[model samples]
Target: MYRSVGLMAWKAVRALAMSMTVVSGVSGCAAVQPASRTAGAALGLDAYYTQSVGWAPCEEGKTGEWFAETLAGVECGQVRAPLDYRNVQPDGSSGAQTVLLAVARRPAAEEKTGTLLAISGGPGQTGLDLIEAAYPPEVLAHFDIVAYDPRGVGRSTPLIQCAGGLDPDLDLNADDTEALEAAERTEVAACVTDTGLDVLRHTGSDEATNDVDLLRAVLGEERINLLAYSYGTQIAAMCALRFPANYRAAILDGVVDIAERPNDMRLGQERGYQATFTRVASFCVGEYRRDGAECPLGTDPAAAEEIFQQLLRDADARPVPVRGGSPVKATDVLDASYTGLLWPSAWKPYLAALQALRHGDGTAVRRLADFQDSEGTNALTAITCTDTAGPDHRSHSQTARRRS
Candidate 1:
């Protein structure tokens, strides 16, 4: 389960920090020249994308299907880059081919502050969508928002491939774990090694940081404002570290400390779960006491936890039918509970889920299961795994199963 690290405390600290900073980072603008197709050296553009993905223009009220679609009043374009950034013209035709997928939006009004580049997370998550959503009328009135998807990601060519099937809806029983693990192992081997070690090697915080500088130059911004989330924070931090001059300020949500990298994600998530369990249990206990009927739990919270454990074990053996679609399994239950950890808003749904599980009603439980499955995209996993230093071909299926 993913968890926020000290949400209450961090919110206070972040609020204070943000208050100390000025609201507007871009101001007092002089007339700027039009952007050039070629990113020149003067703007500190070291790399260029030679390929691009198309952005279907936004209609009156149409939403971009995926994250990278262009927003209203925004122009969408694609930039192509080399599969290998180091050697741009690998084929010797015209250096190597490189594409940078880009989405830029501005207010319908003429006058605007500047462009604020919005970056998304998952390393694989589409940053373009964030720009379109975050840059509503209020923000758009001030600045044009630009976002891009990195290589091997959304709309970016040569997508990373995981050998295993990512059918989130599939129920993974003990009988299925072995097959699932094997498939995952196969998929990982294929996707990670597809570009060989070079691209995979370069696909870290450092390279992404450098890429931002190139983007800044290509977009023709003297300095850019950045709003990033989750893994996007890592990319922004890298950009700041490498090209501190390129940024005015950055707003980071679900921020990740660069130094923490991969280790903190799992450990921090576990701590967050432990805390949520405490909060959720309190809610359950309070509700049980208020109802006073049979009490949700036979005895106290301790007994309730025991009952929950029993439910999980039972679910593992055989799925309890819910929603008329399929039965709810332990894995489904785990995923739903884990999804709740992503945000405080999910607490209510989680509460409902627990009640449903208690009564053997699988519909509510299935909803949670579906939410969990929704997130199990192949791209997210690839990006996460690639960010780490490990054997691209190695499979942890056996280990994962043993742990389970």
Candidate 2:
């Protein structure tokens, strides 16, 4: 239910009409030096938290095959965060198990208001590309913009990946424990067999938000403002919770309320998704017009909702065939609709997808679903599974129901 936007690759994603088909996608300073150590001391952390970063021209199109060229004026750096925070030595020897949080930054056009960290949502998101795509020059002028690839995610050294790949055939039925456990087993086995699970065990939110503190220290900022989308909201809130003084400000987008954060997230999502989808359905059917033709769903919004729901059920019953690719199942359609629901700009394409679905075409849905299990989703799987317990684990009790 908490889909990672970084992995989505939703749009053509061109910066100034620069097309980014697959070109994929930090830090500072002195004065900057003593001020950095003081900030770390104030935050009650060690030297790594106060460590000065070596900033350099990003390896975009130069060295790392992963860095993209269109993200202009972005500088890269790597700062260390302890792999194990719980077992730190008295003299602050946590650096031995260190991992990197790759950072990208763009300085303010003139004067600055500390660092504005644009944290992307996902236990496994890469936020650097987002700074240029999501923020305008005006916003960037207010403060130096920064984004980071959290450990085990993109461009972070020794990147963690699953051996068997993500499971797309996951069943969402309330009664389907067998299918769910099987998927989890396959996923966990892959991580254990392919990479050390020990690293993944350390990849949860505690370390990530601590890494945020480490980052704040690197920038020599006493407190950092955050712009977080979706799951990044979780990270932001935790940062505020962990080091309230160090979080100067925060702006959250998508799944904003901290109370509705990801415990029984899937079930929580199902509770509200239908209402939101209905509103979209009503608008599309009532106002959508193309080529002077009647609205695709005609005039009845309820009928449109029913039609879409029926399609999902039918896909569950039997997969819908795509023209040249794999079949679109119920889960695939659900994924497409969920992807479209996150942003309003996607509504037009969503309408197109519905039209395609009506004609027994699975292309639109497949394209939307492709983002869910992209070429590099294993990190997402590993990080996400490591971060939160299963939604089903919380479904059986009164405490869970009350939390919902």
RMSD of each: 7.6, 8.4
After TM-score superposition, the amount by which residue 389's alpha carbon in candidate 1 deviates from its true location, in angstroms, is 2.5
**lDDT (0 to 1) per candidate:** 0.55, 0.63
Model 2 clash pairs are 26-75, 26-76, 26-77, 26-103, 26-104, 121-232
Model 1 misplaced regions, further than 4 Å: 1-56, 59-74, 89-93, 100-111, 132-140, 163-184, 192-203, 280-310, 322-326, 370-376, 390-404
Best by TM-score: 2
lDDT: worst 10-residue window of model 2: 395-404
Give lDDT tens digits, candidate 1, residues 1-404: 22232353234323322332332222221233333443332221243533333545543233344433333456656554444444444343454445455554554354565556766666566555555442334454556667677666665555555544455555455477777887667666666665454444444444556567666666667666676666777777666655555566666666666666355566775786777776666666776446653333344666666776777888878778776677887887777776655566566667667676777787877777565232225566655655554544542211110000
